[model samples]
Target: MGLHPIHTSKSYHDKDELGPEGNEFTSREEVFDYDFYKKLASDPKVLAIGECGLDYYRLEPETAAKQKESFIAQIELALELGKPLMLHIRNAYGEALEILRARPGARGDVHFFAGTWDEAREFLDLGFTLSFTGVITFARDYDEIIRNTPLDMILSETDCPYVAPAPFRGKRNEPSYVSEVVKKIAEIKNLDFEICRTALLQNALSFANIH
Candidate 1:
């Protein structure tokens, strides 16, 4: 069975309560509400707590502290609920690593990982799986990281509707297109396509604790 979870980023979502149509909103809260997250994450369908983390791509000093505040809340939420995390770290690996390192027994996958071998190594050392997207199918961006990462510790994804893989780069993306990402990973790791595919599936299952 294809068991997937309800994934989202509470860290980046606006603090204001969104309207029913999702366009209108209320005044932003001074303190972010972990209670709202706690209710949603308690749902059985929600397997992970994230797509959340630091993103210093824009480097707004004020937002950086806020981002860390939201990130740590989600991290604690994941740990409290006994669910895995799906991190969305970008241009702030060191900070992300520091936060995660302090929390013993935290486990998850770092989605769309775009970091150096050293950075990836630190995450791997924490027993977190590193996930790659269709970005690897075109640019040589993460080829070395893919080559160096162990097959079992790697996960393949498509980041659908964005970053379409090669041979279909200009078109819209979908979950089915993940096959190309898997194929590229197999090629990088020099393993049979089926072997890589199976290992990745196993990793996903293990990451979400779908025994």
Candidate 2:
């Protein structure tokens, strides 16, 4: 797997159920230890500071508030660490965008982005990139968005062991399936396959701040 660099992220989730499972569980307090994050973020191998953001898909109002607090704190950490944010937003783009917009200079990818072009534009305007998963292969819903997005602003991901692409739709997804995602982007944008592949590779490397 030397094909791509591995960039680990540290994030804070308010709910206990959402934290790490089993004996290795991370408590809410530990999630917000600025000094702990500073040490991890200081590591050159740990490229970014997230997969963290608002997820209002499920939660009570109080829990959602805590998620927001955690999200904002992680954003601060990314800014401090001078690394890009690896965001995971769902059913809460409006709230997420508000918090992201408040930060001004903050930048990162909206990983597995499944939002509208307008929402995507807002992220692009913030100087952030958008990464897509294997969903685009079977679903035509995202075609226009894929076509509309600037090539430099797009990257490929495989939110796997799930969202496996077509022809392997029901199986557990592996990183290799990301090539299918890349292929779909090329088809949607009507670009030559190699050009799309290289652009996406460079886009991911550049936006993720990997060497």
Candidate 3:
């Protein structure tokens, strides 16, 4: 159980939780809360700037603009802080990539990627790592992408409390289940489990800039 927790923030709701009492909270300000995140990112243990990015899976048109505005702010903060980002892109991969492309030099991972190969390649070309969740265990759609991605550009996650891997499917997920994700990667890449394991650990450390 030797695991380093990477801190992450989202550019979205729960105004009551983070908002000042009785003041009207705007999505842009609340989502990007520069001062709040700057404080957190200053912590030595805090490794990244987000789980913040675009999520258009069920977005309303009005809120979409705010979401993009918030995302850009976080991206700017990531660049300013020199910390990597932990992106959460859902159905808006195209827009997300466009924004990230415009803002060069901010390193990040596209957590729980479920995009097409072309989109994946775009991110790879832009120097971002792609992380897979336990969904790969029960679904074959990601198998090709997993096999095609280079070892250095790949990482695994549990997305825990959701999407538990096979043999543990339909149950609550935990960090320990990430081994199944690594196992799937080994099978897809046709590499020995230990080698794949070592390489993935190295890739993760490198991506997060951990020594």
Candidate 3 off by > 4 Å: 1-29
Which lDDT tens digits does candidate 3 get at residues 60-152? 656577678777888888888788888888789999999988999978898999999999999999999999988898899988888888999
Regions of model 2 farther than 4 Å from truth: 1-30
What is the TM-score (0 to 1) of candidate 2? 0.85
Clashes of 2: 1
**Residue pairs in collision within model 1:** none
Least accurate 10 contiguous residues by lDDT in model 1: 1-10
lDDT string for model 2 (17-40, tens) is: 232221232222323566777777
Worst 10 residues of 3 by lDDT: 1-10
lDDT of each: 0.79, 0.76, 0.78
Q: Candidate 2: lDDT of 129?
A: 90
* Candidate 1 residue lDDT tens string, 71-120: 88888888899988888887899999999999988899998899999999
Ranking, lDDT, top scorer first:
1, 3, 2
> Candidate 1, which segments miss by more than 4 Å at Cα?
1-31
What's the number of clashes in each of the models?
A: 0, 1, 0
TM-score, model 1 to reference? 0.85
Q: In model 2, what lDDT does residue 1 have?
A: 6
